[model samples]
Target chain A: MDLRVEFAGLVLKNPIITASGTFGFGLEFSSFGDLKRLGGIVVKGLSLKPREGNAMPRIVETPCGMLNAIGIQNPGVEAFLKDKLPLLPWRETAIIANLYACSVEEFGDLAGVLSGEEGVAALEVNVSCPNVTHGGAAFGQDPAQITKATEAVKKRCGNKPVIVKLSPNVTDIAVCARAAEAGGADALSLINTLLGMAVDIKTRKPVLANVVGGLSGPAIKPVALRCVYQACRAVGIPVVGIGGIASAEDALEFITVGATAVEVGTANFLRPDQSFRIIDDLPRAMLKARAADMAELRGSLVLPGQ
Target chain B: MVVRNCREVKVQSVRFLGTWDEASDFVELTLENPGWESYRPGQFAMLRPKHWGLELPWGRPFSISRLDAETLTVFFQVIGRGTSRLARLNPGDEVVVWGPLGNGFSAPPETPTLLLAGGMGIAPFRGYIENHPTPEFLRLFFAHRVPLANYPYLAMAEKVRAEAMQEHTPEDLPRIIERIRELMDENHGGIALACGPTPFMRTIQEHAVAGGLRAELSLEKSMACGVGACLGCVCKNGEGKHVQVCARGPVFQADAVQL
Candidate 1:
């Protein structure tokens, strides 16, 4: 059972990439499993300058999920390149940098900073983070801004494949996917957490200090699959499915629905070794799904009345 | 700086040793040790029942109340949906346990140490008292809203010089605060270690900082991953920068964190 997946100018040993934010710098989880075993590692969201993020009580647990307003707290791209990136096993696995910025030019500047590093295999443009006040879901919710941000990163990102991660908060996700495609994104990953909120009825206050946050985990799997399905049909570029992917079967569900690969997010918190477990289980899962390889299963969803 | 124990953190599926009500809502649970390195006082673990489904996605974090060669113990109150579910588990059930996590409470053996516990805040002191090299140098001052019998006061009282005070109302806080100040004065240059609700810990922090007394606080925050990766359980340090409680500490020095 070959789990290799080739998409967006990168060939992964498997379709199991740890999503940004949840997996930290990839060094934190080194004790749980071998990092080289995974297909890719999308590190924590990085910016041109270090971000302090939201105030305390930034995350709250929801039903079978969690809402987080981390605001992309990171040590900036320079710190990552100097202090963190050299320590990662990027030679064995794809180290995709997830870029977060408040402006289009800043996104390009961040991409340019990372694109020169041989360790960085790709740049994931995060215009869909719902936790921040600016340049997050604001840019993702608008198709024009999505095009502009994607184009700016593409222009400065040298030869590194640019993946536009789309938000699910918008009314029409397919339109956003098409907008990224129009701006020359090599691939698309959807959906970056749904906009949600939780309140403490006793105190009559919001659970998260940020008031609203992005919801992730098993609760959002169906929504992520729907968004990925629609986006895959709407765009010519390959789609990488993310959201609530905890097991090999969950990853296959995304692959079956037209996604070339899948990224495990919140489940990384549930079980630290979840991504490695999924990769180990994929061969058996492929056997159970009656597919010899990912290519045979990719986009194999049978529509109604087919 | 507190000397931290170097231990390998691992996740294991261990057998549940059942749970019992310690006092009213307070419950104590035991589990078979998962064969990791021995943990120190104030270290914690993330626990989730193996049978749990999507209804409860993440594991709950608890301080290690006691640990022996065969099993480990944790104390928690039924405050929310997670603990209520945890209180009903049967023996022989499998549970996913991770850690011996975070920096635990630490002080030199010869130094006189004041252990201030607020209600359920007494959980970690059991391990601390049991492991302390010189028990004569430790003093425990416990303050609670509930009856003194509702906590592990009597058991801890036998081991060290212990005192209990009841705060029946907000007005009673001054008496408790006065008692804590007296204890700090008695211990003089000794260090104060506290664990409790935010208000209780805050009071300790304020008084400890003001009187020039050295202190360490065990903070409680809702955490997703017991590791620092989630960045969910961060508290501001004295520098006003957010530091992860799960990684940097659940136990922080008096002046280190803003409280």
Candidate 2:
């Protein structure tokens, strides 16, 4: 069966893409499996300057999911372009850079810096990181800021497709999706992570040093699907679903809810070669679902009344 | 300059041999080796049973306690939900393991090395003691709350000059600390390697630095991914910069990290 998918002016060999932050710079996992087998890789979030991130104990496992407050610790955009990008097999696969900045101007500047790079296929704007202290989920939670940030990146991004990654902590994900569309976002990816926290009953201390973190994994899959479905209906642009997607069946669930593609996030931690395995299993998953291709199954959800 | 060895790491499915109770709470697990490249002494691996579902999503990181021609051994105490589940595995059960990860202990072969460990901290020394070129020159001082019979002390003691101390109460800490200081004083100009609880490690680190002695420490942190991608297992360095423990080290120089 054909597994190719074209969305937001980019063609993926398959609908399987590794989410940002989880996949590192794409080189760390190269030893686990062939990097060329993946349809796309969204590298860790980059900023204008290197970030030290939060204190120790930045993650906590809760039930089937995990919460992280990494605070988008990266080596800055320049270091990535000079040191990391040259080593990736960008010629065969899409290398999307995830951007993190403290302000609209910085976001635009970061977009300008990466958009000119030949190896970077696209720019993923990270307005939904719940771990940082400022200018993260704040921009994603406010419709006006989301529109402004998307517009800022779009204006300076040149020909590179700008994907606004939205937050699930917001009240109405459709409103945020429409806001990005209003600012001319080529596509949208949701949801970044839900805000949550854990506590140690014995020490009476917060589990994470940052106290609150973004929740991801199988626990957040239903919430992610709900956000993606609402956002897909509200906007004309393609939506890439992310959040706790572990298996090909999970990827198909997002596709069935109107997502053009799905990004494997937290599962990459559970198993480094998870994305590659998902890609290999997609054709079999499609056959089991009795579909000719992704298009045949895209948004095929049935309503009870209908 | 200290040269660290880098090896190719891969995920493989191995068969569980069975569990051997080292003590009431501590157990040793043996697995069939699937022809993984040779691993150094202080390195570790992430292990998960194939039957595991979402209840415990990530694998637990364990120090490579011992490695023979055909089998790998990992020792741990029943700590939480993950270990509790791991302790119940049957023989021949399939388990997914990936490793020889993180930088391993690299004490200069010529130097007389003092292996200081506490409780479960003694896990990695079995391989360290057996694999050392000069096993005769190695000395181990293990401190714990339980009896010496509860640990792999005797097995390792046969390979090196091993000694054990029991800390029954907080008041017993100074006596153990005094023993460590005495060991450091006697082994002056030599190197010390340590692993254990934070305070125990901190005590060793403090004395090592104050005495101007070279020391290496193996740190433990709650890690989601044993790889560096998640950035979850980071600790501040001596320079106060955060470095990934899983990538930079689960083992670091005494002066390299804050504690």
Candidate 3:
């Protein structure tokens, strides 16, 4: 009956949190449902300075999935703290600030700045964003860079838990997972979209203006599951799963595979109240799996001992 | 209970009004009004179409062309797969729509309104002219590459009964500006409102700036979520700040944006 989850040291009401980029500043979706009822709100990815993202046609649709290159467009750290932070109902719900920067020092500075601010329960280091020109995928793809980014964030994040969101484009997700855990990450989240591209045959041009964009949604769910499963096995810290999670059944799959929590991304675009819908449906799914609480569902996947 | 006003995205079945080929690749869709009767002049609706297990995954934004108390209409050109699928549906067939969304045009009703429309940009102005409190003070300058054969323009002109002017030579920007100036002069402090291709809108913005004519423009962007949730439909302001076109203003003051 208790749906509470300890995600990255923060006690969330439920496991369903709105993914960073999809939820905007969390204020926009208040019209759809009660923000306080959900587990948490991960406001869109923020940077040290305001980023003007890519050109037009930053998104395209594939089979049951979507590709977006919305380059972590935010109002910078100062504006987010001054304007967006106060607007959040911090007393009622968990507020996770998803942070991105072009360099290790910038990541530390952003984390440091956010640490001093009240109401920010956790810091989600968005090193895996494929949309930015630099410092995003560059930091996520390599274990060394991932370790450095994690260390930078962990150093100045104070008592706030640091969650390093891993990129799926890497060859071995486990290696990056180990690196993040080695760098003192309290928890890990995967997968932050797969680097992919779509083409418009009629125009003989790439559909997204950036040519290559990060593909998310149902199309990448399988890949996400595999990565989350691998990352969970590789690291000792808690792992949060995100990718194409539209239903309670989808969230259960992640939990069964060892993800302590899940974030709903692209589904929010279609159904704004998806987090509440998934939270509402979670109990039925857990009951079907014969699990009394969410804690029992973690790593419950039965694999054949070959 | 405090009724929180949230935009609802639903799968409502819309009956095809008519498909006009003479107008060169344009389709008009009609749907029974869902709860709310009226939206702002330049506000739009999102169409959800699925085929071959492939969907847009998000609502496709289209300006509301015409609306009655009981029904709402939208006009769109076959630009990509989304609109192509919409073109295939028949009058009796059903298509899903999420509607009456975004901040629309804002102009003082007391001022004489000059509408500059290029190609299919005439869609939103139809609703604007119809919904205006004082319709007689409205004037339209519609530009197209060829002769006027579209049913929408004719239907709009007839329904609104306002002075509608046509320009066949679309490339003649100087002449269009001159015409706008003459209309502004006649109205004694009139404002221009335009919707069209980027170049057309840009030229209108340019003229509106130079002539000191207060203007508003409706922009077109490749959108995912018609609601403000997705940061996909962002347009840069004159200050180069990224503003959500769906949340802030699909219709914005001419000088506020970079076009």
Candidate 4:
């Protein structure tokens, strides 16, 4: 009853991969569990130039969730390619690097650099950073911007598979998902951290230095499930369901909703070995759900008419 | 990560051992863990209020206040969010505890020691004096407003008794050196160890040099990776050499660290 999954053309051993922002370049967790044991390790978002990120207080804990406005701090694409890439000891897992940009050209430039990298299995093009303050956060909110951003990345990526990460801040996520597919996205990952805030009541100010941040936790589970349900139906490519997937029962929910693969974010910070815990729980969840195999549960989200 | 269960924890009761005004919410918790019989100076522990949701790691670092080899005590000022949350908890509550990490103070047993403390910098000195009791040799305990006469608990033993040495801010380096020279003139040679803020440490080191006293100064700085990977807590020493406060020395030789 164990769930097996494939993302784009890459076959993952399991469906539980740690999400990007939460997992710091995949090396830190090597102490508790073997890196090759789980599915994949999504590296943090990279850009054409290095970034110091937002000021201090980048993260704060709200009721049942966390708001992080880290602003995608990374050591640029050239440095990542030179310094971080060669250090990865990938045996049974895939290394998916997430790319971000303030403009289409920067996104395209990042994709171009990753496309030639030998160890990278795929590219997760990030169109949804919230802390940018200006037009930078616009790409993932509108369908047109999503399509334009995805197309720009796809054009430069050549044969590289692009997974367009969509934000939940939008009104309707399906429209945004369709645009990503139309612009040549190979796959999709849903519900980047939901935007939320925690205020210091006494101080009459926000807890995080950044006034608001992307929220991720068990608190955002229902919204994330709904987003994954919508995006899976809107696009033909694989949907890697993310957001609030901590336990095996949580992973099974995304699998039943038509997610070919799933990512464990925020939970990674809480428990570095959460990928293994979720992966360990999946087989028993499948047995309890009485599912035959991963194929049958892949698209169990059929409509009434269908 | 290796699970070492707590044996007999002494002093189950916690008392607010300092000025408890709401404006400055600092608490010195006396956890009654008789089993906590072993702890080194300069080491810290992370404890959370009992049943606090695991939203954040229950473990936040706190400097040890007093160690009786049976009962472990710690002192912390409520500064930001975590400590504020901790201030709300009461006695008879159990916070998840993970502890005794990183290198502690090198409090070599009383081979003639000179102890210098500033403000709350006196926290770790309690343990050092208890462990290394040297009365015959001269020792100096520098306090802001004569904390010894106020606290009175430290100088109770002859093996560790020391005279109060007061040095006002920035201007009285010469007077401070004269006091140190008078002490060294009498006893076996001792190492000068001071713990205070950056500016306070600089003055102590300067005065120690004028008196020709070999000194070591402990520092307090903002830190993220206390174990030395993040490079977040780097401070430049006199030689322009950068040192990690968490890993290298919360305690540094006065002459070694320019500040």
Candidate 5:
């Protein structure tokens, strides 16, 4: 009753889950905030092997968003399989394994390995990570490729739900949404970081060593709301909206716009306790919105005349 | 027993302590919060210079150079965007400030002390000179490389020496060992405190151990969550257990660290 949210196949206890890349794994932040209380956790971006990632200056600050080119620097799947997951104080929280690859086979191979493994409740077919150079943004940018990766993993995953993470970097996000939906994605999380960059004036250099990076924060709030609103209308599946979510009000904005759920990204870095803060504030937010239940708040927004 | 609130600060001033060619900017900050009770010489604070709407602050772990009750001094090399933007900051700009957290160098009851820092690592040494300066019980050895131009506070090295019978050496640096040995001889039984890259700290720790001197070291790690949840900032200790450099330390007893 306190913090639960319902998705297609899962009944999440709270809507306050740690977004991928930012939370690292459940092991470290457990000391700061109880990971068990989270709706779930999306661990670091994993491919087949551990990645050293880009050179120095992997992260930079924009006006309100951050440009990070860590290029998904994770200790590949095997290392994560061995080192990171076992340590989480997971309890009942859903542990979502986020997988990425340049080729369809790599996604399939990686998904095949994780499908039967312990502790993973779902597989987030990640074709939308904007930071890396190769397969990530490429596959995510094209709807055809989005379907290709989704179908590949769907063939490998037996009972697990494959939630495709969609990129807002595209011209038409719903085009990519339909592709994932068509390819049998059980669910979708929209609006990954919008690609962006900031430059230094006196020196005349681009801020990130990678030249450009994903932008996330309060600045992107409206864009995220618009994207989620449209995607929810287009898709036949649940949509988890993410972008510039900093407060309970910000989260409710996503839910009202038709997002079945929402993922808080850049805000978690500002305050480690932010997720819990949102959890505490959600019920009051529901009360303020005058919704009897969380689901009633979903799609509560109306157009000018509708 | 305590709840620390995160505060956003603005950059009031950013300037090279010496010359522009040095690429070092000592950023002065003013935030909504006044600050924590007097910080230690080697303590560091994490900062997010206004812009990077990131949920997390991306400030590098830097030592507190100088602090008046209202502001904190953060010295950084203008290597990347964070520092370059920080360099552009004039008075009245704002940033998100969190810290004065982590283990600071122990200056226990002023038994006797030797302070060493390299390059921009000279930050915390200035704090020690200002805050922990004691007359007879503690002695200091402040050394850095050439072009002691912008850093006028090297003068503080001499001031600490006047009372503690200290030795001041600003060497071209093949003489770094010679200068340190000379100071150690004059001030035996002194506790050695150091900060720099791992190798620099390792060299100082070895020298201190070889001479049977006491020492403390500050460590650095790549961190996103400075308060320790990310586990991104992990460093191997002597026991081979990976410890959170942010929560477990930025400061550790010299010999206890594996490095």
Candidate 6:
């Protein structure tokens, strides 16, 4: 029944955090469920300057999932701090800032500004956003770039924990995970949507204006779990699992495989109150697994030979 | 009981209300009155077909064409996989719907109201005229390639006193504008509301702006969450702020949007 989890040194009421980009600044969801009930909320991806995002048909539904190329359309960091940050009920739950930029310095600068802000509990550096033309591919694809971005943020982020959200497009996720850990990341969250595209045959054109997008939903759960398993083994830091988590049982799969926390993304689109439903049902799931708390369930996966 | 404002719901009585062609369809659903909010004209709902599993993961937003105490009706063009699957729904099947959402039309009282709908844009006008204090004060102008008989709500439009005109080509838009101009001149103090494709609404907005006539518009966008959280259904207003159509609108003053 005690679902509390200590993720990256932040004690969450539960491990169910609304993933970035999917849950805009958080106030929008307050009407559906009690924000106070959520473990945390990773607000929409933010940057130093506001982004206009992509063109029309930014999203397209695929098999058991969706592809989106929203390109992180956010009001610049200053506007967010001045106009939007004040709107959140900081006392109710953790607020993790999902920061994206075209360069390492931009990431550091944004992290510094957010570090001084009163309510932010952590900073989620987004190096894996597949929708952008610049930083997404530049920083997330190379282990060296991952180390630089994570170290830059850690240096400027004051005492707040820094979580590097890893992209699933890489050839080896463990290499990136180790690099982030070496750079002093308090934790890691995987996997940020996989790169994919869908084409409309009638017009002979891709469904999204950007032509390609990051795939998310139940379709990517197997890929996500595999990545999480690898990343957890590659580093000493905690890993937050995300991808197709729609139920308590699904969340348990990640926790058992060594994810210290889990964030719900596309499922929020299907049902805004899904996290609340998952949280409420975790007790029965725990009973079924015969685990009292998330701690007992974390990293409990057994290997075939060992 | 109606689960008003509770975005997650399951409702039965999924009856296909028949269609004009394979491309257009109507699905009527009934929900208990408790837990749901009574909807206003111009508001919309999000519908999702159950049991399709991952093939259909999200809901599509539709204008609430009609609303009774226990039933809500929506009309959709079977354009994609979700709607195509919805087109096959049979009576007694259950579907998930949530809403009565977004800011709906605000019709000024006792004033003549002109409704300009392009193609399937006629969806919300039914709720407006039926629930109006003076239904006789409503007038409509619909433009679509299909004949009046094929228009989804032709019978309902007739009951509400709609005036129909045939547009043989896109070139007829200019002639249609001329007609709207004449109507505007005749009803000096009337309010105009328009909906349809972006290009269609843009044309109406330009005319309304040029003539200094009061107009409101309903916009359409690709929305993942029919709530504000997804930030996907954004529309730029006169101020350059990206507002969510599902939250701030789906309906906005004609002057309030960039069109």
Off by over 4 Å in 4: A129-137, A301-306, B1-59, B62-259
True contacts kept of 2: 0.54
Q: What range of 10 consecutive residues in model 6 chain B has the weakest lDDT sum?
A: B1-10
Lowest summed lDDT over 10 consecutive residues: which window, candidate 5 chain B? B162-171
Tens-digit per-residue lDDT, A1-306, candidate 6:
789999777999999999998888887777678888999999899999898887767888888889998888888888888887788877778989999977778889999889898788899999864335454455788888788888899999999999999998889999999999988899999999988999989999999888988999999999999999999999999999999998889899999999999999998877667778889998998899888899999999989998
Leading candidate by lDDT: 1
For residue B91, what is the lDDT in candidate 4?
A: 66
> Candidate 1, which segments miss by more than 4 Å at Cα?
A129-137, B1-24
Identify the superior model by TM-score, candidate 3 or candidate 5: 3
* Candidate with more favorable, higher lDDT: 3 or 6: 6
- lDDT of model 5 at position A42: 85
Query: What local lDDT does model 6 show for residue B214?
Result: 86
- Of the two candidates 1 and 5, the one with more favorable lDDT, higher being better, is 1
- Write down the RMSD of all candidates, one decimal each: 3.4, 3.4, 3.5, 6.6, 6.7, 2.8
Q: After superposition, how far is residue A102 of candidate 5 from its true place, in Å?
A: 2.0
lDDT of 2 by residue, B1-259 (tens): 2122222222222222223354346768777764565778888888877788876888889999988777778888877888888777877777777776788898577788999999899999999988888888899999988767667889888878888999989899999999999998898888888999999999989998888888899999878778788899999898999988888999999998997
Off by over 4 Å in 2: A129-137, B1-24
TM-score of each: 0.94, 0.94, 0.89, 0.70, 0.72, 0.92
Off by over 4 Å in 3: A129-137, A201-205, B1-25, B49-54, B67-69, B87-99, B145-149, B159-188
Tens-digit lDDT string for candidate 1 (A136-206): 44889989889999999999999999999999988999999999999999999988988899999999999
Instruction: Between candidates 2 and 5, name the one with more favorable lDDT.
Output: 2
Once fitted onto the true fold, the runs of candidate 5 whose alpha carbons sit more than 4 angstroms away are: A129-137, B1-43, B47-113, B118-139, B143-193, B196-224, B227-259
TM-score, cand. 5: 0.72
lDDT of 1 by residue, B128-241 (tens): 999899999999999988776656678899999999999889899999988988888788788899999888888888888888889999999888888888899899999999
Give model 3's DockQ, 2 decimals: 0.45
Worst 10 residues of 3 chain A by lDDT: A128-137
